[model samples]
Structure formats: structure tokens, C-alpha cells
Target: MRLSQAFQPTLKEIPAEAQIASHRLMLRAGLVRQTASGIYTWLPAGLRVLRRIATIVREEQDAVGGQEVLMPTLQSADLWKRSGRYDAYGPEMLRIQDRQKRELLYGPTNEEMVTDLFGSTVKSYRELPKTLYHIQWKFRDEIRPRFGVMRGREFYMKDGYSFDASYEEAGYSYFRMMLSYLRIFHRLGVKAVPMAADTGPIGGDLSHEFLVLAPTGESEVFYHHDWDLMDWGTSPLDPQKSEDLDALKEIVSKTYSATDEKHDEASWQNVPEDKRRSGRGIEVGHIFYFGTKYTEAMGVSVSGADGTAFHPHMGSYGIGVSRLVGAIIEASHDDHGIIWPDNVAPYRAAILNLRPGDESCDALCERFYQCDPEGLLYDDRSERAGVKFNDADLMGHPWQIIIGPRGAKNGMVELKRRATGERLELSVDEALAKVGLN
Candidate 1:
């Protein structure tokens, strides 16, 4: 994309309200703009990253046999009332009234609604197990919505629901999701630790929260230093048939980790002193098995093989899609700007026309463009060399290819790695090859 024609409103100074690194960098780079308190309009660049993450999440879910569906954002209060959570839900549940004076709610989560949907569709034990998921916008009215999109009142989220006939079978689905989520985060170049967590309002005894250690995280977490040593993603997931629950528990049991709520001094003492690393972590994903909680409450029952009415065992998984943008930055950014992973970076490389109007520089940049380069943000703006350099660094693309008259004379262009500030002078063809534009 050409910078001259792009709608990036880059700011020289940080916004007064942006008090953290993620918020500051997001504003300075023109990735997003505040539409209101805690609500944002994702500018082109920001939308690109958001979509990339959403795609990865969807791919992982599909790989594990999850079917996708869309649910209404506005739901009737009747469902919540049936689940006995209409009054239990706090102010965050954005309550509203239609012109008919019917109580409606912007769903904070889709448990009750999904239960109502699933109950109407399936009625036999043959379709005992099914997994449904959706990527949609969710609204939770935060009293103090700050820290940019990190704690936004309105945000996009990917939520998945699982239904089964038995508690043991649904627990397997939880394990499958845990394994799938590990790969999802690894593909995005972020390491997440699956720590046992308390199921807040989601109502489940068994839950795990995927935590990404970030300096600016809200909750302090304690864990063993070898959290990354386990290969959870490579583990087998055979949810259709029976699996060893004890073996899976053993893997998670090896790690001593918990959010502050579950941190126990006795358990922490059991680990070697050197392996203890207590720090703050951002909650990226949560998976839980809440069997018969909403299904029975909403009367979502199906006939079993024994010809008896049975409530389908159920589970729910969630990832804060919009909040992850800030969490990623928190885990992987430097002083210049956000160091985006290649998988999520808007553009893999930035081709800077150092001498924009110069004949040789413009000609070479035009050739690069003519070649239909992949993932290149061509900066062909008529600006000073220093200004271009600073902006390129601020954007923090992985590779920077600078074309100038001085280098064009020598048939060479400067290639620099954004993360390490390492540079190599290469011929036009070599520069193209280095960035895979060739």
C-alpha cells in the first residue's frame, strides 16, 4: 500500500489519555482512532492486523472440527432469565429496551443463547457431540474503560461452545481446545501458559486461562520457569473416543502455575526455588467445562441411547480478540514502536523511496511496485530522508528496503531488519531476493 494515498493519520505526540505503551504506540502509528470512551474505529492498518488474528483463530478451530455460526448480538432477556442469570449479571451486561418495551441485552457471552439454539436443533443421542464457534463483536459496559483497546467497553471476540452427552466427553473437548489454543498462539509468535484459573461468571468448576506474560499485565501470576518446555500443541486429541484423562492431567500437573486467586504458598514451595518466576500476565484465552449448567436450566434436553431425557454436557471457550492487539504489543514491543510478528504484521516489509522525486530512486521503486511485490508498504511520499526513516521505524515493519540515488548509482539498495537494526547493502535483485519480492 502507498503511504501517500493511505488514510494513516500518524501523530507526532501521544494522546493525553493513552497512558500505556500499547495505547501510545497504537495512536502514534495511526492503527486506530477512538470513536468514544473505550470504543474505537479500526483504521485500515489496524483492521488488517485484527483480521489476520481472527483468521488464525478460525483456522485452528476448523482444524479441530469446530463448525462456525453467527448468533445475534442482541438477545432476549427470557433466555438469561431461564438460566437464572438475568439478575445475577452485573452492570457490564448492557441492558436495553426496544420500542415495544421488551427487555433486551447486548450479550456479554453466548451461553444462554447458544443453549437455546442447540436445544431447538438436536434432539437425539446420535448427534451427541458438536462444537460451534463464532467470531463477533461483544459489548461489556466497563465502568472505567481505559488502556486503549485492552479494556474496551465494546470489542470483538471469538467464542466457541461445545455440547456432549457426558461430563467425561465434554472434558475431552476442553483438552482439545487447550491443545488447539497453544498452536494458535504459537502461530501468532506469542507464548501462552495454560494456568488453572477460577471461572468467574462463566460458571464452571474446571477452567484454564491462557496467560501471556506482559510487563503491563493487570493480574500477577506465579508459575514454574519451564512453562514453555511442554509441547501441548503436539499432543493427540481424540475427543470422539475415550482418552486418558489422568495422562492429560499429569502434563498440566507438572507445571506449578496459577493466577493470584489460586496461588497457594504450599504448592509454590514444592517447586525448586530456581524455577519459580512470579510475574504479571495478560489473560488471552479461557476454556472451561460447565456441564449441564445452562443446558438443564434452559431445558435443553435430548433423548439418550437408553431412551431417557438427558441434558447435554456443555463447555465454552473465549479469546478477547481486540484486547489481544494490546497484549501482543505488551509482550513484544521496543522503544521505537510495536514489533509485529510476521504472521500479524500489516506489511512484511516497507519499501522506502528515499529520494521520492529523484529519477533513479523513483524508477527503482516503480520497478519494485511493477514486480507486484508481496506485503510491501511502499513509502513513496515526497518527504525528507530522515522523516521517512523515522516513520518507517515507528511503523516497525520487519524489513526496510531503502532506495536512493547514491545506492542506485552503485546498483545497490540498503536493506535493514527492523527488529535488530541490522543492515546489508545489496543489489536490486539481491534486495528483492532477501525480502522474497523476487
Candidate 2:
């Protein structure tokens, strides 16, 4: 992508309403634009990051036997009414009427709708352990939607529901999702601690919230320091093995982690003082086992082995797909701008023509850009060197390939790592090899 032709509207100053680092940087870096009080239009660069995060989420869900399905944004109020939550859900749910004056709602969550869909199709225990998920937009009508996408009223999310015939089977599905969330966060370059959380409106006795530690986070979280040292990848968790899943659950349960609402002072005192860690955290994912909450209310029962009617135990899992783009920035950025992780970055590297329009400089940058055109963003704009450098840092590609007149004359370029300002002057080929573009 050439900067000259790209639609990134970089700003020199921060927007007045952006309060946190992620919010401010998102505006200054031209990732998104506010279209309403709590709504935003994701620009091209922002959409790229959003799509990458959603892809990772989908892959992890699929690995754990989650089938992808598309669900509607607008839901029939009849489902909510049948679940006994039509009046209980409050103002967050946008209630409306269609042409025929029938009641409808913009779904804040999909629990009731999914239950209605699953109930209308399956009639026996054979389809018991099915999990369906969708990546789509959701709205919650926040009274005060600030902090950019972190707390936006409208945002993209990945929500999944699991149906099982018994409580024990539901717990296995819960544990499988817990492991999947850990793997997803690890791959996204953040250590997200799974903490016991109140189920809120989801109405579940068992719930876990995945929180990323950041100074600008909204909630206070307490955890054991051992979470920082443990390697999730090395854990013996096999999705196919029930014993392995149970073992994983045991490992997580023994760890002392909880949000402020669920924190137990007595339990905190049990841990060694040195191992106690407390900090502000941003919530990125949540999973819950609601058992028969929806199934019982909506009469979504199937025939049991004994020929008796039984409600399917169910669970719901959610990941803030759009919010993660901002959360990742909050966790990974420095003073310069967003330091996107390689796996989720819009472009792996930026090709900066330090002396744009100069024949040698242009040729050198062109060579590197062509080597991996799809993976590189070429800065071929008619901007000053200072502007180009500042913009490159502000955009925060994982690497920057610098092509200056002097170096380009000698067929050389400088490769700089974004996270750490490490620079190595080498030939164009060497630079490409360093960035894995060769």
C-alpha cells in the first residue's frame, strides 16, 4: 500500500474527547473516526487490524469445535419476551417497532436468540454438544461511551454459544473455551489473566473474564504473580481429552485471580505477600456457563435417553473483536504510536523513501517494496524526511526499512525494529532477509 494513495488521515494533534492512550493514539494515527457520540467508522487501516484480530479469534474457536454461523443484528422481541428478559434487560437494548408495529430489538447479546434458533431445530440429545459462533456487530447503548473503541456503544464482537445435555458436559465445553482464550491472547502478544468474574446479566454461576493489564484500564484486578512466569503453550491441554481438559481446569482454579467485584480478601491473604500482584486491567473476553437459564425459560428442551424431556445446559463465550484493536494498542504501544504485533499488524513493515523522488532512493525502496508488496507499506509521498519519520513511528509497523540517498547510492538500506529501536545498516537484500521478506 502506497502512503500517497492510502486513506489514512494522520492528525498532528489528539482529538479533544480521547481520554486514554489508546483512544488518543487511535485518533492521531488515523485508525478510526467518530461518526456519533459512541459510534465510529473504522478506516482502512483500522479495518485491517480488526479483521486480523477477528481471524485469530475465529481460528481459535474453530480449533475447539466451534462452528461458525451468522446471526442477525436485529432480533425479534418475542424471543426476549419468552426468555423473561424483555422488560428486565433495561435501556441498553434498543427497542423498536417495524412497519407492522411488531416489536424488535437491536441485540445487546445473543443468548435468547441463539436459544430460540437451536430449540427450533434440534429435538434430541444427539446434537447436544454443539457450539455455534459468529463475528458481528453488537450494540449496548452505553450512557457514556468514551475511551474510543474500548467502551464504544457499537462495536464488533465474536460471541459463541454451547449446548450440552448435562452440567458436566457443559463444564467441559467451558474449560475448552478457557484454554482457547489463553492461546488466543498469547498469540496476540499479551498476557491476559483469566480471573473469576460476576456473571452480570448473563446469569451464570461460573464465569471467567480475560483481562489484559494496562495502566489505563477501568477495573482493578488481583492475581498471583506466577501468571507472569507460566508458559501457556507448554501446558498439557488437549481439547480432545476430557481428563486433560479437567486437568487444565484444575490448574486455572488453583490460581488466585479475581476482579474487584469477586475478590476475596481472605483468599488474598492466603498467598505470600511477594506473590500478590494487583493492577488495573482491560477486559477483552468473557465466558459463562448459564446451565438452563435460557433453555428453561424458553422451553428449549430435548428428549433424554430415558424418553423424558430435559433442558440442554448451555454456555456463552465472548471476545471484544473491535475493542481488542484498541486494547492491543494500550498494552503494546510506546510514546511514538501503536507497536502492532507482527501477526496482527496491517503491514509487517513500512518502506520509507527517506529521500523520495531521488532516483536511487526511489529505486531502492521500490526493490524492497516489490520483494513483499503485500506485506509492506511504501511511503512514496512528497513529504519531508521529518514528516515521514514521525508518521512511520506513529503508524508503528513492526519494522521500518529506511532508504536514504546516500545509502541507496551504495545499494544499502537501514532496517529498524519498532518495539526496540535497533538499527542495522545492510544491503537491500540483507535488509529483506532480516525482515523475512527475502
Candidate 3:
């Protein structure tokens, strides 16, 4: 992607209504633009980042045994009625009427619809423990939607539902989803702690919210230092292993972690003062084990081994895919701009041709871009050095390969690390080797 040809419309001044760093930076970096009060149109750069995050979500979900499926954004009112939440879901549900005056809704979540789809297909316990997921757009119609995509009326999300034959089997499924969430955050370059959470409208006694620590977060949470040190490594998880999943759940659930709504002062006091940690956090993902809550209400039953019929226990898992773009910025940005993690960065490295027309500078940048054309963004615009530096920092590519006239003439370039203000002047080959672009 060349800056000269790219459609990113960066702003010189921050929008007055932009209340947070992520929101302001997103606009200034030309990642997104507001289309309405709570809706946004993701521009090229923003869409690239969003799609990369979705890919990571899909990979992790697949690893945990979830089958991908596409579901409609507009769901029939009959589906919601079957779950008894059509009226109870409140104004946020975005209820509407079609030409025939039949009620419909822009799905806030997909539990009811997924239940209906699964129930009508799977008919026996032999097909139990099925987890299906979809990445799609959802609407909530927030009365006061603010904070950019963080609390937007429309956003993209990855929502999944699991069905099991018994409560014990459901528990294992819950653990697998929790582990998957942790791994997703780990890969996305954030530390999201799982805390016991109220299911609220989700109607579940067992629920956990994954939150990323940030000063601008909406809620203050308390947790032990153990969460900071414990590592969810790159090892793969098998959802079918009940014993292993149960053990994994036990380890995480025992940790002292709670959000403000469920905070326990007594529990907080019990932790060693040095081990106690408190901070504001953004909720990025949530999982619920609402066994038979929807299946029973919707009359979704499967035949047992003995030929009797019973509702399968169920759980729902969700990750805010679009909101995560802002959440990542909130968690990782500094005063300059976003510091995108390598895994989800729109471009791994940017080739900044400071002296664009200089014979040596153009040659170096052109060669670098050719090496890994897809992973590099070439700044081939006729902009001043200061403007180029600022834009590169604002866009937050992990590495910036600066090819100025002076260095280029000497067959040298400067590699600048975005996260750290570290610069290394090396030959083109050395620079490529350092960034693994060779």
C-alpha cells in the first residue's frame, strides 16, 4: 500500500467529540469515520485491522472445536419469542416491523437463533457437545452510544453457542471457551483477565468476562498478581478432553478476580498486599453457561440413549471483534499513536522513502517492498520528513524502515521500532535481516 495512492483521510485536528485516545487516534490516522451518532464506516486501514483480528478470532475458535456458520443479522421475532426475551430485551434490542407488519429485530446476540437452527437439525445425544460460531454484525441501539466502537450501536462480533448432553459436559465446554479466549488475547498482544461476572440478560449462573487493563476503562476491577505472571502458552487445547478442560478451569477460576459489580472487599483483604492489584479494564470477551435455559424454553430437545427426550445443556461465548480494534489501541497506545502488535498490525513494516525521488532512496524502498510486498506499506508520497515520521508513528506499523538520501547513498537505512524509540542504522541487508523480512 502506497501512501500516495491510499485513501486514508487523516485529520490535522482531533474531532471535538472524540473523548478517548483510541477514538481520536483512529480518526487522525484515517482508520475510520463516523457515519452516524453511533455508527462508523471502517476505511481501508481500519478494515484491514478488523479483518486481521477476525482471522485471529476464527483461528482460535476453530482450534477449540467450533464450526463456523453464517447467521442473519436480522432475525425473526418468533425466534426471540420462543426464548421469552422478545419483550424482556428492552429498547436496546432494536425491534422493527417489516412490510407485512411482522415483528423483526437486528440481533443483539444469537443464542435464540442458534438454538433454533441447532435444535431443528441435531436430534440425538450422540451428536452432543457441538459448538457453532459466526462472525457477523450486530446492533444494540444504545441510547447514548459513545466511546467510538467501544460502545457503538453497530459493531462486528464473534459469537458462538455450545450444546452438551449434561451439565458436566457443559462445564468442560465452558472451560474450553475460556481457554480459547485467553489464547486469543495472548496472541492479540493484550493481557485480558477473566473475572466472575453476572450474566445479566444472558440468564446464566455461570459467566466470565475477559477484560483488558487500561486507565480509560469503564470499570475498576480487582485481581491477584498471579494473572499477570501466569502464561497461557501457544499449546493447543482439545475441547473433547473433559478431564483436561476441567483442570484448566479449576486453575483459572480459583484465582481472585472480580469486577466492581461483584467485588468482594473481604476477599480483597485476604490477598497479600503486594499481590493485590487493581485497575480499570475494558471488557473484550464474555462466556456463559446457561444450561438448558434456551433449549428448554424453545423446546429444543435431543433423544437420549434410552430413546427419551431432553434438552441439551448450553453455553454462549462472545468476543467483540470490532470493539477489539479500539480495545487494542486503548491497551497498547502511548502519547504518539497506536502501537499495533505484530500479529494484528495492518502492515508489519513500513518502507519510508524520505527522499522519494532520490535514486538511491527509491531503489532501496522499491527493493524492500518487492521482498515482501504484501506485508509492507510504502510511503512513496511527496511529503516532508516530519510529516512522514508522524504519519508512520500514527499508523503504528511495528517497524519503520527509514531510507533517507544520506543513508541510502551509503547503502544504509535506519530501522526504527515503533513501540520503543530505538533506531538502528544498518545496511539494507542488515535491516531486512533484523526485521526478518529477508
- Across 1-438, the per-residue lDDT of candidate 1 in tens digits comes to 889988888888978999899999999999999999899999988888899999999999997789999998999999999999999999999999999999999989999988999999999979978999999999999999999999998999999999998987787788878777888898888888888889998898999898899888888899998886765556564433345444566667888989998888999999999999988899889998988999989988999989999999999999988888888988888887878888898888888998877888888888877666446789989888888888888887888989889998778899999878899999999988988777
Candidate 1 regions exceeding 4 Å error are 230-248, 371-374
Q: Give the Cα-based TM-score of candidate 1 against the true structure.
A: 0.96
TM-score of every candidate relative to the true structure: 0.96, 0.98, 0.98
Q: How many Å off is the CA of 157 in candidate 3? A: 0.4
In each prediction, how many residue pairs overlap at the backbone (N, C-alpha, C within less than 3 A)?
Answer: 0, 0, 0
- On TM-score, the stronger of 1 and 2 is 2
lDDT tens digits, residue span 165-268, model 3: 99988888899899889889999999999988889999989998999999989988999999999777654455557777867777766779988988999988
Model 2: per-residue Cα lDDT over 309-397, one tens digit each: 99999999999999999899999998888898888998999998987779999888888888877778999998888898899899989
TM-score of candidate 2 relative to the true fold: 0.98
- Tell me which residue pairs clash in candidate 3: none
Q: What is the alpha-carbon RMSD of candidate 1 to the true structure?
A: 1.9
Worst 10 residues of 3 by lDDT: 233-242
TM-score of 3: 0.98
